[model samples]
Target: MTRSEATPLTIAYTATSAEPGVNIAALTDALTHHANSALFPGDGEVTLVVQGRAPVTFDLTPMRGDQIEADMHKKAEQINDQLNHMLAEVAAHSEILEASTNGLDVLGVYDQAIAATPQGGEIVMVTSGLSTTDPVDLDAAGDWQLNPSGFVAQINPRDIPDAQGRSITWTGLGQTSTSHAAGTTDPTSTRARPNSQQANKKLHTQHAPGPAARQALHDLWLNLCETSGASSCTIDDSLLPATPTTATNRVPVIEFDQVTTNCLGTFTLAADIAFSPNSADLTQAADKLLAPIADALATCPDGRRINAYGHTAEVPGSGDGIGLSTARATNVLARLQQLGAPRNTIGIPTGYGDTRPTVDNTPNGAYREDLARLNRTVELTITN
Candidate 1:
């Protein structure tokens, strides 16, 4: 089961008040199963770190099974026992510390783990992901709407020390929980069946986030791991499925249209590339948004003509929609050429303005800004 005898493993965890959704028992069981499997190398050293206002670290016994499967099983059992005890200690300490206003710092712990581990070592994070610390405060209101790409763009990779070539795993993200006073059992528990009046009474609760928020939380971590240059990234969301089920609010960066005769390909750029009001200048984020499209266009067969068409929303007060749209298309094509799309293959940029909106500008005599946003887009078409 050993890939290399030198690689180490680090398990970093945080237990906060909002941790009912994370089943520590289940995680322990999963870890125990993995300890006996090929996933954990017999020679790898393991460490456990509990993240709080100040992180605590524990060095666990290494696996010394030699070539005997029976010896490996014995060592695995010892490791499992040690891990369980460490997790219980973390939980007890967190319960006592929950009264403090400062919550657990997940990113800080991650940075520490990444710095400590070698290049091929794995770092497993067990967290509720509701960090209240700097760098990234997942508990903030604005963070709930953060998209993966946008959120990753905000982070400077240099801040994470020794991040390259590491493997990362995250569990129990976006899960929140509530609890009642001591001696009060959970009303929903099967062991207790209180009267109707007792059941109807309200208890202090931390409402779980909706599907969209959960998805955003998951995507944020996934993107962060990718940006950190992890050799592999895995999510062990035992309570919830690892894959997010709900659709996100943001539109896809680019959507390709069906190929037709005389047209090599066509794609629409909508919410992916944002622009300021009545402005054609590309934002700082435009490069990241357009890089993939430019890379794809660069791979196209030679001699194909590339054209860009820009459209505008039909707002009455918006001045010179045609002129603005033309400038926007021209800027996009220029940027594409700069990003390695063939400059010689570029065709004239055109402005359809408010003439070819994908959606209705007004519905039931009311203007819808959301629909108008869809109308304001640029389409890139490649032809024979």
Candidate 2:
């Protein structure tokens, strides 16, 4: 599953009080920090509403006397104290419970409690990240010059006090790299969840690239050879399909009938490479397939624009709605941008959902693969 829809991550909260000094906004910020700061944390989302009076909550309890501020300095300890306790309580009964909190009320009595909790789910605090107006860059590009200097990633979650009457504490780790390598302050030092390590490990397991991606790679290799002055090249087994779903799929490789080389020029090309699983991420084979294009762009005059549009078969319950084709197109565009393609020169991606099918949607065994192949094509157009 994509990180957004992954399990073990959820946030449901509402503020009981709506007082200004209590700074529901500030408390929200603190709680967001708590959620993101956890070790081996899953992707989290939060929704909050304010009720009659704001309620303070936390994991660990803070000292008896302390002042509350938006910065969450002294008060953070109190909130963290309460939050820890609440997490334990909720985890014990309802594995998951929607948590929330209010801060700086001057009342020492039991302040925080969890309600409407989910059964058999882990209890995790939720909050938002700091807000900033900065340009952010995605790191899939081989070279980094394509991105702007300043980029932003934001997190903001609501604050909640724990079961123990104290406010929760959270630490915001600012300035993380998209690569996710440990920043200046090492991530190992921070406390993490029990499943965090195992979870990350499972996430990294390898899988083979999907068929459309492999075919696109093969086509790119042949395209490059024909364009370049090469004596001869062989299509390796790695580039061919291991199993054939149809007659065409069984072909060893989409090898050129005859190699041709004459004139060399640079042109731009774009396509929406496909994958098996429901994800936009490109596999290594996909990258290899596109490498020739990148190489041509960098060196050959005929280097194409390489729009990198995405496409998918029209399937039921796939949310293949109106804008979905457009989304697939944009996803392709983004990949090209990330690959260091000249940003200004490339055209915006456009999708043709089953609109311009190369074959009938109806299945007819071997023939069905041809139509699907044609529909799944990443149409490449060359221009000066």
TM-score of each: 0.47, 0.28
> In lDDT terms, how accurate is model 1?
0.57
* Pairs clashing within candidate 1: none
For candidate 1, the per-residue lDDT at 282 reads: 82
Residue 72 C-alpha lDDT in model 2 = 49
Report backbone clashes per prediction: 0, 72
Ten contiguous residues minimizing lDDT sum, candidate 2:
244-253
Weakest 10 consecutive residues, lDDT, candidate 1? 246-255
lDDT of 2 at 383: 47
Residue 216 accuracy (lDDT) in model 2: 32
